[model samples]
Target chain A: MKVIKTVNIFLAIAILILSVNLMKPLSITGSSVADLSDAECYFVNSGVSNDIPIDGCCYEVQKQLECKKTSKDYRCYTSESSERYYVVNANALNYCKVGGYDVKII
Target chain B: MSKLSEDMSKDVKLMIVLVVVVIILIFFNFDSYGVSGEAANTDNIQYEESTNTLYLDSLTLKQKIAQMVITYHKETNKERLQDLFIGGIHMGAKTSKEEFMNSIDNFQDGSIIPMFISVDLEGCANPFENFQEFPALNEINTKEEAFKVGYDEGKLLKEMGFSINFAPVVDLDDKIWKCRSFEGSPEEISEKAKYYIDGLQENGIVATSKHYPGKTLMLWDPHKYVVHAPISRNDLMPFEKSIEGEVSAIMVSHIIADGYANSENKPSVVSEKLIGELRNKFTGLIITDEIRMLGLSDYYSDVDQMYIDLFKAENDVILNFDINLDNLEHMISVVEKAVIEGEIKEERIDDSVERILNAKGVNVIR
Candidate 1:
């Protein structure tokens, strides 16, 4: 019985610790430096304009969408910097504006 | 026998104590589900079909606050929200047309005032992409195509029992999603948007012109936790046209602004200055975009404070998609407390409820 009591106490303590550490609400800690990767650089000129440049090396978004067959004016290109995702028409139009080389997704 | 009885007594006491502790925790957790401390206006709610009158005073303070909030639709929330008389249910991307219809029926089943059934059915941001395809706004060059798209989309949405369509994004530029904004100069965009608004509203679907105080589709600054947009005169034109066209509601974005339109460094959704300015130009419902977005929440240390600010901002409707019903109830309680304390006036609540009922085609009588 004493052994069981010790085990229960330890279990309760462990559960409390896990709850405090893991049950926090999710927060978006935005990037400090720009991520010019394809996934990050996508959605230029498609949803937003890239005419005016910001003071950054890369642009980060919540999500990156692929080029839809229906949208010809809206094309996505791969970013030469990261080689991971596609930067859309806006980013492709003015890749040099944001200080990066925009590579068209062939 | 006596020894056995004593041994059982200790174990029974321990069991009772454990059960009591659990009961207390459960009670605390579910407390948000019950009536809050606001002095409920007498529950004599009635609608006279003969006179077409809805007694506004009949609703309790909780019901009024519930009417101000539009929550994300979940199967679990249907019955609870029906009881709370929540004003609206926003449908996210769902699998099928049948699923969307069924969900709408379930939510509107026992609601006193028919809840506003809303969805984001824009050019590229189509939730109905699986079942049907709609032309992206950028692809629509002429006002004729824009009107046709709006009228067709509105007709289908009404058939599906959707009351509101958050579309015709009037942001002057769309550098992000090139397909969202209509392809043209500000004046041309305005003309197309006006035709779309007329098409939707004529079909009994409330058209909401959105991301107001403009420049929302601009790129974000990663260094800033809350994104800010530099608004220009061109950015205001589409919205001005939307108001002139008499759109039903305008959805506010989370971008902080300070140029032609100023949010005073606060996200436009919670900024009274911006909302108040828009109210001067438009008497329609001013709605906040999804309140759960990090851009709005990041501006506040305490989430409860954010809820209070949203109410104080005087928006006619608030979109909170927290998914947890308890958090929603907690939000209602916080606003109720603010109202009781005079931080937010009950009259303000009345004003919003009146507008909401008006939009729903119900006549409100004080």
Candidate 2:
């Protein structure tokens, strides 16, 4: 009789725990940024036009910093010293200015 | 005799325990079934025509314009606040959740009259940290998870004092990265959007489906410039499907579809051929996209002129987000001028105001 009473108490406690678990609040987190691949170099160079080869040197900077090259007359760099010359037009330069890109005139 | 009584007592005790367990199981099962049955009944109520009404009231041109335009967050001023009392303010994308709730609370204080507060909460999280407290301005995501999310948000928004939610963006994008198509595909969008709309509207927050005739091809943001959508009748199928749903409001987009059948180069907002003719097919309220978008302001070159043209086209509501309350006030005056000129009749203004007031469920007149 003692053993039966003990088992019943254990079963009741287990059922109460399961019910509480079912009532637990649900939380959902957004997974928006998980798919994006990290870029190697992040730079903001002015005078880099939209005509620049996006897959070459420009792709790394664009994907990393969300920057678009708006000019044909421009230069970009991994560091300040190793600057690569990229051509962009005047209209593209204006586009860069409007987009708040930092242009260094070398 | 004592042994016989002991056996009988054991049997009685066993019977009582079995009865109690059965009662507990039945109670739990019935409670679950009852909750779901109530939800199904509410869904049925949405389709009933008993809720539809045609409110006919005499309203001035100013009241009509007030009913149409919603101002952005930053454009609230004393004159602007006064204008909202006289007219309504268009809640803009730039407006934070906190600012909107505070404005609504202040408006409730009788300093400014209650105008319709419309928000684009499609892709945004609740901008207010304490949004739960207001209950009226809670944000909801359009996901499969939306059933639970919307219920919680809608319940909270009702508590906070919000009456309208410009939400459940039914615009389906074939392209994956349209920057704002967070909901689903065309069929999926319809299903999820219906669920989300029903959830919010059931809780009393009016759900508005936006970017009408769909926004799948909007390459450029209309806030900056006129966007042209290059799609055929196939793309428009989703919007047509969406209209068939229990949507309370439909917001027209500023996109121009040159390729659309007979709608060459004309933005949907000014296209009487589209918004007036096509949308008339659906018996629902029609609202224009933001007046300040490039398609409206830059393309037309005159906001007042554009409003007149749009009104002539039978566009019901003018949506503007940029906080230029001064411009909204001028727009109201323009509509008033049109009314006096006999271009737009007082009855038309009354009809529009009635729809606006009914949509907001509040009276403008104190």
Candidate 3:
């Protein structure tokens, strides 16, 4: 009876481990967002500060912040308000992640 | 007892099978576990719906002409070159050909915009004129001399990966005292221009015949201020012949042509009737003399407006000098604004950008 109980306990532990492993998450990142069809939201932060030289759409930002892309990081200013919202697809969240800033999923 | 032992073996096999299945599932799940929350959020960020092919397809007629306009020494940084929306660079006597040639290696890496290399070699006495380092072809006097000079320079430029050359001043020197002119008559100038352009093109360099509508009678350099040319249509015969010969690119002179009703008192480079109506008489590329010249700069209060006008006038390119990173960004913003306002079409922008990329020998992503 003890031998049978031991086998049953081993099988139960294996199943539990497998289920836990399956529940883990996934993410992605890069210069291009073209491949992110599955993402729920997306944002481009050209990392730069206010008072520095800027061009294109970044200049239109009312805060006068410089939006520049660095080698390994992107820089830009974002508010905690509704202005920070991004449009993205659902599967994209499974494929990529954000760096250098705190981003909330919508 | 034997049957009972067999059943125990089967149970052991079943346990092994379950463990194998669990291992396989964990291995596949590992990839998902590695993704961070930050990356997941980034993937969900909103982006404009644009494809690589769509970007390439957005070229317009005006932008196509803009692509043919080449500049030298105006803007040096990647961001600034992006603003001019130009297809090439015309390196003047001031730029060292060797150093300029060596810079091509750096361009192999991708950039937001592309630039081509073109150099002015007329009246350049320096050994490194047009970036040719060889000892034999520095000062081209005879047709035979021009052959070697053109061939060797074109070869070097090609090896260095330059795609264009704005050279072989085809202007007739009617006035012997003019230091800039090389003492060639209209016929001789035409012949030499043909030979020089042909030699360079043969070696895979796009040659540009410049100082269009001629520059023989200008009293002062247009780079400092507006210079008047006293010559008539007869004096511009060489330029007409260059167009007839199908030169790849032609640069308009800043000097206003005398007795020409539409262009008098106005530099031919900026005049709509000249660059647009008259120059458009031909099919090749039409480029302005230089945007930073006092002739154009003094007249236009807003520099961005000048580019918009030039685009509207149908000239393919504008040569910009005294441009740096900051100014380039402003120029790009101006163009973007123009697009947003419907003053310029997105197709025109893409066309110019593609030409710039082609001149740089890089593949356009769109």
Instruction: Quote the positional error of residue A84 for candidate 1 in Å.
Output: 18
Which parts of model 3 are misplaced by more than 4 Å? A1-106, B1-55, B58-76, B79-86, B89-99, B111-114, B123-142, B174-180, B221-224, B344-366
Per-model TM-score of chain A alone? 0.24, 0.26, 0.27
**lDDT against true structure, model 2:** 0.49
What are the runs in model 2 whose C-alpha is more than 4 Å off? A1-106, B1-58, B73-80, B83-87, B90-100, B111-113, B129-144, B174-179, B182-184, B216-218, B221-224, B258-264, B362-366
lDDT of 1 by residue, B1-366 (tens): 888677666656655565565555445444433444443332346777676678888887778899998876467767778767789987755556897899898888766678999887885646675576788788887898889999999998999999999887888777655567887898999999999888898899999997887877765654454787888888899999999999999999888988888999899988889988988889999999777554676688677788889989999999875555666777887788789889998998999999999999899998
Q: Per-prediction DockQ scores?
A: 0.06, 0.02, 0.06
Model 1 misplaced stretches (Cα beyond 4 Å): A1-106, B1-44, B49-52
Better of 1 and 3 by TM-score: 1
lDDT of 1 by residue, A1-106 (tens): 4444454455555555544433222211111123423322343433443432221112221112233322533343222122222333443334322222122223
CA shift of A10, model 3, Å: 68
Please name the candidate that would achieve the greatest TM-score relative to the true structure.
1
What does the lDDT read for residue B306 in candidate 2?
77
Q: Per-candidate TM vs. native? A: 0.74, 0.57, 0.54
For candidate 3, give the lDDT of residue B338: 70
Candidate 2 C-alpha lDDT tens digits along B150-231: 5665675676567666665556652312223434456666666666676777887767776677753335431234567765
Clashes per model (N, Cα, C within 3 A):
18, 21, 44
